[model samples]
Target chain A: MSINEIQDSIIEDFSMYEDWADKYEFIIELGKELPAMNELYKIEENLIKGCQSRVWLHAHEEEGVLKFQADSDAIITKGIIGLLIKVFSGHTAQEIANTDIYFLKEIGLQEHLSPTRANGLVSMVKQIKNYAIAFNLKS
Target chain B: MGAITTGLNVQAIREDFPILKTLVHNKPLVYFDNAASTQKPKIVLDTEYHYYSSQYANIHRGVHYLSQIGTELYEKTRHIVKDFIGANSEREIIFTKGTTNSINLLAYSWSSAFLKPGDEILITGMEHHSNIVPWQLACQRHGATLKVVPLQEDGSINIDEVKNMISEKTRLFSFTYVSNALGTINPVKEMTAIAHQAGAHVLIDAAQAIQHIAINVQELNCDFLAFSGHKIYGPTGTGILYGKEALLDAMPPFEGGGDMIKDVKFEQTSFNELPFKFEAGTPNIAGTIALGTAIEYVEKIGLDNIFAYEEELLKYGTEQLQQINGLTIYGNSIHKSSVLSFLLDGAHPYDVGVILDHLGIAIRTGHHCTQPIMDYFCIPGTCRASIAFYNTKEEIDLLVTGIQRASKMLL
Candidate 1:
């Protein structure tokens, strides 16, 4: 699927919820379904540092498409990361680098998140972009 | 549970705080983050609005009608703050941005002049980062040593350790009057005496204590006391650093700018006297006036009344929260204030805070800017419920319910 299509699907999925409670419940459920990262990839080098909740994101290029796995100690953060992963993973590094991810704000995720969570979101996006840049350099 | 005489019409008092009536997530807002910052009363908001609308001007600069009125109101706050903290004179109170700024000012100004190589600055383990980092920087700059007064198991500083630590080389002893993270009310009065006996100066970070307790710099006999306005129902970016007049007069000015100077030549600049020399800028004129009203608002409520009322809330909160299975409270200091720092078993503090936030129960989570204390306690962070006088038993009950809900959901 295209980036825009995936994001639109995510937005549509979130908009199905009537209230914040339902939205959060859905997010938590998504977090539970996120594929677990290998424990070896959970080292400090792979960890995103700025998040209030500890999150580890690992990326590697598979046949010119970027694949990612992540986990978080906090369920909400895990859910948020899961959402990010669903959008950005399985895409070309170039597409991931250039794409503007507005689905968080489109789905009111930014407005719902606390300041710290918002910071965590920003950090997560930056790490993804950094990974894309690294892959671009290697290629 | 035993109750103390507060002599406050708390329901009427709540009416004065417009934010207290606010609803969040379909629930009445239960704000228990007073140590982070207190909600402003309507009187403070009105005072600021009135000042900006009519009485706005650059203070201590212009001779115009508005400037004079602004100067009077702004200077009046100095006198008000002096009386609020029971300082000997208004000259001792130098307004700064906040507690962090105040501490930084002291670190730069006082330490530069007084500290030397091998001299020690003693702070405690439970100190907020604001209290710790400034001294660390100062020590680094001056080639001085920094010492820490270790905490007892109950999170209170061991006074004997402090006495043992303060020696001929101990130049400054700085500590918090109350731990914002732990809520342990340190024995400042006794500690001040000990520091003074060792011929060392003392600085008390009263950011957590000023709103809950009566502060008399003269009575505590501390050389310096720092507190922020926002923590006590005033505007942010405004605070006071109360220094002994002699000490302030001797130290070099922290920053030099207009209003802090008597006259400036191309080469030589003669500095202004106490308070103004340290203040150094166009000052937060509106914020200062608003802080005056905030002090008056709290004074009218009376610190004794606030103390009694908040202590009751603390006690009630402690008892109720203790009933939760696998919940552990930090800082069992016998003389604590209105802070309750706790953790639920098998649950992260961020998860608990998120659950509480959804329930419209505001609390502070994470390290509370005192990472060393978290390290000492062998925890990453805690969910801290810090109360103000406006909080009620009902709110405490909601917090208990919220915690239970969070525990059930997360664990």
Candidate 2:
């Protein structure tokens, strides 16, 4: 979708929900729309150890860019992985390195997470960034 | 199942927890996250209140009346804990901040002596991070190997594999009696037996299990058992370490402080006795005294009763969750604690928890600190509702209704 379309949808999402509860409901609903991942990424090496849901992620750096895929036993968590991939995928190590996930806060969701979930979020980002760092070292 | 004070009436019991009466968004707070930390009962609250108000003084070494009272109360908690867990003696119990600290004390003191290069420390795939990370550090320092016993698809540890995994190289084995995330109740006696045969000391992270199940430390006979009082409806920053008398006597002091030393010379100093050697600095005296009262409250309610009530709640929750479309509960173990972990069809667990919170129902939304277990299930995190004896079927019903509403709103 174009930036205009995305912004319009976000505004619609804000208006669509009546309250924080509704907003969370809508956000979770948004998570439901995320596509499922292939089964190959479900191994321990690819699995993120701290999520409440079993989340698996695989990334390969190809032609100076990184492409990643993620899936989870949980649909909504898959949706979270989907959201993360949308932000981090196809971007260079440098792009991923430079990106700030403050949008989570701007979207008014970070504070809603328990400290445990928040830490998992940090781990997820760190894993991606560390992967980028590893790629940087290799190249 | 028979001893539960479930017949005692939840309304009266709920009244005892001040947090239950507090309103959130004009709704009574429905706290379902008891596996994390239970809210203080009135008895525990009053105990702390009384301690600070009347019995505030330095314990173990005091001449005044207030100090005398403080010392007596503090020492008495050790005895209460001994009776609470069915420990063989009061000397077996050592006070610490919580389960994490107690486990660290064992790791640093004993692991330092026992673990060496190529030595193996056995653990389970279902251990909480607190149980996992400390051993990881110990292994890293000593060049010891870390081996994990595989968990069955239903989240139960494979005891056959546990027995097979034991070897002469195995120096220590530690696992949770009840998994904080999945709520899988491990067979502590059998697991401890396997470790002892392999000549390895076993540390049971009883943090979750002690509150939910009846504990008989002597019967289980593990080398060390650790649990936090907060999980058992006691005050925070207080816990117990139940070690074998010989083990406690042999292990080195965990910290250097005013309480843990015999006599400080310019060159060398002797350490204090069994329990004090491990309890360094000014401990959480108020919390410890309050924990004693908390144990009294649990005993009054009764452990068998607590377990039975939680089992009923778990069964009820599992059945209700099964009715929701696009929902799948994880860890289908026959033997389980009162925690329910599940994934909503298309909703984030955090989103579920957040939405539920607005409805005045509080649930934990995350990995429950067992990140490695989360990895095994192949998800980012899960929505967990941990029930306590104080929770009611009515609350579970409201929780189900709220989830139904949430599912409609989200999916």
Best by DockQ: 1
Using lDDT, give the best candidate's number: 1
- Model 1 lDDT per residue over B249-349, tens place: 99999998888988899999999988789878788989989999999999998998899888888999999999999999999999999999999997778
Candidate 1: lDDT of B67? 92
Candidate 1: pairs in clash: none
Q: What is the TM-score of each candidate against the true structure?
A: 0.95, 0.81
Badly placed stretches (over 4 Å) of model 2 are: A1-139, B1-6
* Per-model DockQ against the true two-chain complex: 0.50, 0.27
Question: Runs in model 1 with CA error above 4 Å?
Answer: A112-119, B1-5
Count backbone clashes in candidate 2.
15
For residues A1-139, could you state the per-residue lDDT of candidate 2 as single tens digits?
4323443455554665566665555556556666656676668888775534556778998888898877655444555566677668877787677666654554565652345654344566678889988887777
Interface RMSD of 2: 4.4
TM-score top scorer: 1
TM-score of candidate 2 to 2 decimals: 0.81
Tens digits of per-residue lDDT, candidate 2, B1-411, equal: 222345556677788888888898679988898988999998899999989987798887878899899999999999999998888888899999999998889889888667789999999999988888888888888888899998788999878999899999998899999988888899899999889998999899999998889888878988899999999999899999999988788778888989899999989999888788888899999999999999988888888877877887788788878988888888888999888898887676865775688799989988788778878888867888889978887888888888887777766
**Candidate 1 reference-contact recovery:** 0.35
Error of 2 at B371 (Å): 1.6
